[model samples]
Target chain A: MALDTKDVAKIAHLARLEVAESELAHYATDLSNILTLVEQMDAVDTTGVTPMAHPLHMSQRLRPDAVTEADQRDAFQTNAPATENGLYLVPKVIE
Target chain B: MHDQSIAELAEGLRARRFSSRELTQHFLERIERIDPTLNSYITVSTDVALAAADAADGRIAAGDAGPLTGIPLAHKDIFLTRGIRTSCASRMLDNFIAPFDATVVERLAGTGVVTLGKTNMDEFAMGSSNETSYYGPARNPWDTTRVPGGSSGGSAAAVAGGLCVAATGTDTGGSIRQPAALCGVTGIKPTYGRCSRWGMIAFASSLDQAGVLTRSAEDAALLLQAMAGFDQRDSTSAREMVPDYSAGLGDDLTGLRIGLPAEYFGEGLDAGVEASVRAALAELEKLGATIHDISLPNAPLSVPVYYVVAPAECSSNLARFDGVRYGHRCEAPKDLEDLYKRSRAEGFGDEVKRRIMVGTYALSAGYYDAYYLKAQQLRQLIAGDFRRAFEQVDVIMGPTTPATAFELGAKTDDPVAMYLNDIYTIATNLAGLPGLSVPVAPVNGLPVGLQMIGDTFAEGRLLNVAHRLQQATDWHRAAPADPA
Candidate 1:
């Protein structure tokens, strides 16, 4: 199925990318071409096929329930774009 | 001395022939002279590296040196390094100095390797070629006009150009092998879980495997032995025991059945590359190895399947980069949606945007089953082909890339054309198998990489075969005529 400008806009929104209205047509076309490639998957028969989460058939490895490394909030957030009071500060979520 | 392998360098360091500080300075001087033209490194931590080298010297003087002591190496920018700018070669993380070392970084630090600096890569490891990197493309050392194969292009270039002894590389769909092949260095991508992905910025987590790019297979063995191990922090880290990769370096390849996939030798493969790989296979035959022409029927479809699976995973992996978090944020946001949109648009590159869009489309409503799920199913078939072929042979042999390193901007405008460069190497990632790219010969002044693929956790065997090939040829040791 061909992706329209509206679909491209929606995907851009979902991805948090601000695609301009003028650029929508380009994304629509480029995304449609990529989708055409992805569309090849439809030809494969996957009935009764269990989706693989990992390549290895082993169970997830578990670790001891303990914090081995000390939380270095001051050290860790030293490079944050905006941090305050040892926490990453973001635009106020609530009005 | 500039072309010494990691093994040779380690031996020299242990024998007091040279101090780690002197070795680190030699590489620093090379980078200062050559890296401006090559653009192989994003950052070179000269002071920190010198300090680390001094510490390594202290260790050797005290007789506590490890196999990698005093050896200088580079890291793909995707791997986090404390107090270092780990940009992943994107403006999104341009100012993002990792607060802590990635598990791989910590592991290597444990082995006493001197980290010269961080190398450039495709932003978040999204592209087949390093052209997508925010820092600009890493030029191939062999032919400066061409690209060094990426997203590990910087690592491969450093080794090939003698900027560093060896460097860490992450492969998601041939990132390690492709560049290694093109740059005429030895690169290996261990099985998916063999190296902990923690702190190695995620890009198609299931497909991403951290490996080493070195001057020789023996150096790769030493690096892999140090990097491969279980990390409880990473849920996918293998709980299995880590093997002594060096011990298996001398393992015989005689009587080993090397499978030549008929599908890999078909149309689109350059005659020059085909001839070089075939010649390398013949050299192995002289070593008592048998070559069996086998078939991986589903191999051709790997490109499409990879585009779907990789993008779908990338779409999810990159979601964390919003205006709200630690990386890049929009200057000012009128609202939440504006924050998200403007931040991403401003932070990411065109290739990254294209992939995120493709990934969103595949995993979007009503298309998940048709595209994402179906692609996963096809990935299984592609993997099954490798398993069936492994039954008939001890290892698989093929060209690392369809052609040698293409010119800069050659395929940049055409995404599909760029994607085709990975056809030979993607199947290994899809199968979670270990693969190595060993330079065989020069074609059109560019080095051709012959890929060696082995079963899961078969890195030792893979390196052994690569080791044998290197011993028989000088291609692995061959450097560019003009190091500058």
Candidate 2:
């Protein structure tokens, strides 16, 4: 229940964020405080309640499979941090 | 002319009293002179707005002017604007621009409102105070050393400072109403899915509802009518009919049953704020409205549940900002994991990183049932409280915030303290109901907003009640002296 620096390190990795080793204790304290706050839910007796996923009770609407979007590679590509030959560039996963 | 309401301004345009170009120029001059101290605007498209104003003038000359024609206003940066930088006040999207417009922006433009560019907001709409914004905190117009309650702080300040006639704001948990309360403006967040979320940046999609901050309830009505409607693109958008919001403003509140929740007025509520809210209730009673004391027993758990649900959803939504496709990327990644980790760390602020980590931890292995699932179950009970309360009354009344706007950097070090600022307003969001804030009075020289919570799809009624109050009082007309 208590989140220490080790827990903070693990969470940072899972979240794909790099946290400096020295700052882990600070985050741990904050996250632990937040967790303590969230523990208030246990006070209520939610014996058979269903978790409300969305605000409304409506089911997701389904549409027939079709391509409604137009190709905007040029426009979309403009926002890419790194691109070459119409493809986004990232570090290669394969050696 | 700057103090005029949307309806009055529309009349002036129709009567040829002032051209849209002249109106736009006036606001531009004000923004130039006043915004340096207030820091309300992020991007101001001067040339584009002038050109749009000219086009609006042509529409007026040809007799095609709408209520919002040539009305220069600002959009919260959360809403996407085509070719305009729509930074969600985060460095991750500081240089990000979408090729299209958000549904709210598209719809508002369809009604002929000129854009004065985007206003600042709490980064990714996460923080209670706008201090988390990358552009720095927006000072309250009422008191320059204080904060304009956020994440719609800039919009609220813009409206209060008369930098713009009105502006768009998105409320996840009291973002619109809290700022409205602090800045002395009228703000309303309609029921979830009442406005399309297609172009609005996602921040807890289920709780985010597009709304407006304006000088008066009537002005809010005029803007909301244009913003609300169904859009096929947004899967959650409702099929309900958009009504004439302005038409119902003069409706009588003779038989209105306003409920005062006991939980809302308890400990932690400032004495000055409670007294101001009580005065507003007394005024409403004089108009034949009856007050019923009610109890939303589960309201206290709203902050806890929100931190869980919002962060959990944010983790999922923000995962798309990996270093690969768009947004900020690492300089030279050794590999994929390093690219993602370093890019996200470098791009995001401390609060953002903390939330993402918390969210990941909540939904992580073995903790999902304890954190995310439990929060959702508790969410049902909190929402149930509103449902039961609504069964007994037409609307619920309370303070918009526990206190008026606090000093800049006052609660910055204490996250929980900042989170509790929304205690009175978060339950409405959790219930997915429409809520509004009407400026009632100033407490300690800072504005206080009396919050009204109506049943789902009751925007018209909320606006009507707020409109009635404004007609009888000049509290909404209070503005700071020349934006400090």
Candidate 3:
């Protein structure tokens, strides 16, 4: 279960973080140690146990499907990095 | 006057000893003088605070005052405050001024409480210490060289330092209780959904809970009374009726069954801390309480399971901050993919990035069942241990932390060591039980916290027990002298 530098790099890439090449070795070591510690969960017998998702044993209430509010597009998107004509702008995907 | 407890301050304001404005200004001045060194506050809204204070004073003049009316309180920067910069101690939200107040903030504001400012915290509540804060680390007011335990460190430090009467804090794993334990203050994390999470910054949604940090358990009780209630807006907000926590503060613990977990008293516990917790337990025994030895067999696996579970949830919770609607975006992005990549890279801190990596890996396609599902299943086992113990005892007593506050950077390099810091506190969060940390003694001249944990929605009983302990000890009154 030892995590390697390449695995660390893959994790960083999946997490959308830019880990420096030099730092990958350190992260690999640190993360591997953490994973080792977490591997202690292997000993516990959770057979026939249904994973508890929420602490409370109640159901969530469902709401009506309705749009009751006005969109404050300008105000909401005021902090956007790139916006044009009441929409978020992104780079062209297709040629 | 500056060091008055929230109860005393409320009474003083009610009795005309001091106006709310005067109290607000006093704290404002203290923040001005001391916060520079402590770095506890990120935004001190003196103008807004004073205005709220003025309004509070008017309410008193008009004979309309409630429990926390006119009281000045700080908030962890994670909560969304209307028109104020609610940075969750990350460059990502550095300039993100929230347009709405968090349900907890809204509830506190409803009580006519004045806002002192937003406190510092670990970025997105990712770290145990406040070092991951983008602005800076919040210095422990007790010993400036040491850390104020985090990510609710600033709230704990400010209350301990007397910069504010009380403040709001959030506990995802052990954020509220752990910091309060280290800083020698009082904090409580109620049943997970007791307080609404509607506007609070999402950490681990299932694990995160909004709580209060203050100098005394009595103060925490009052704040909890205001904050706890059902809100339909937050999907997880409990439908249970909110009890008047302060009304039952004097309930006698004469026949109460207090459980002492043997696992909590075992190795890794500092001798000084063990002595303090034992003395606190002995004091409870003298108060006519019976102590029983209980076992939580799954307790040891809590830390490992929590790291995987919390990080997995955090990874998903933080996915929203990808250079989009609000928060920091990279200056130049060649493409949409580049925008998300560079924005997250530039915005998040190392600890946050590390957690995202851990979480992403745990929740990824191949590893989901082995890591994420396994952790969740283990969470139930840990919780069942508490349920069994509670069936035999009314409440559980233990040291809040295995040791008193350690020096800064002591475990910063070793994340596993840092995660172990919450061994005594994390299990309560996993079980969704109400937990309180009350200062019990001075171990090596540093405060050691005694943790009292009760079953779900039993905050009133929990506070009464902690209140009795505070009455029997002077540890909560100890404060640090001015730093050199």
- Predicted structure with the largest TM-score when compared to the true one: 2
Worst 10 residues of 3 chain A by lDDT: A68-77
Q: How do the residues B1-484 of candidate 3 rate in per-residue lDDT, one tens digit apiece?
A: 6677877888999999999999999999889889988899999988889999999999988889898999999999999998788999999998888877999999999999999999988889877778889998998888888888888999988988888888899998789988898899999999999999989999898899999998888888889988998997899889889888888988888999999998899999999999988998999998889999999989989999988988899999899987878888887788777888888989998888888888999998899989999999999999999999989999998999988887888988998888898999888888888888888887777778899899999989989998888888778888877554
lDDT of 2 by residue, B290-362 (tens): 9999999999999999889888988988998897777888898999999999999988888888788878899
User: Between prediction 2 and prediction 3, which has the larger DockQ?
Assistant: 2
Which ten contiguous residues of candidate 1 chain B have the minimum total lDDT?
B475-484
On DockQ, the candidate that comes out on top is 2
Residue-level lDDT for B132 in candidate 3: 87
Give me the iRMSD of candidate 2, please. Answer: 0.9
Best by lDDT: 2
lDDT of each: 0.88, 0.91, 0.88
Q: Report the CAPRI category for model 2.
A: high
Candidate 2 at residue B83, lDDT? 79
Going through the candidates in order, state the TM-score of chain A alone for each one.
Answer: 0.87, 0.95, 0.87
Per-residue lDDT over B1-484 for candidate 1, one digit per residue giving the tens place of the 0 to 100 score: 6788777788899899999999999999989999998999999999889999999999999999988988889999999999878999998998887878899999999878899999978888877668998889888988889999888999989888889988999999999999999999899999989999999999898899999999888988888888898887788888778788888878777899999999999999999999999999899998889999999988888888999889889999999988565778888788777887888898999989999889887888988887878878888888888888888899999999999888898988777778888999998999999999999988977899999999988898999888888888787777897554
- Please tell me which model should have the higher DockQ, number 1 or number 3: 3
Best-to-worst order by DockQ is 2, 3, 1
Error of 1 at B10 (Å): 2.0
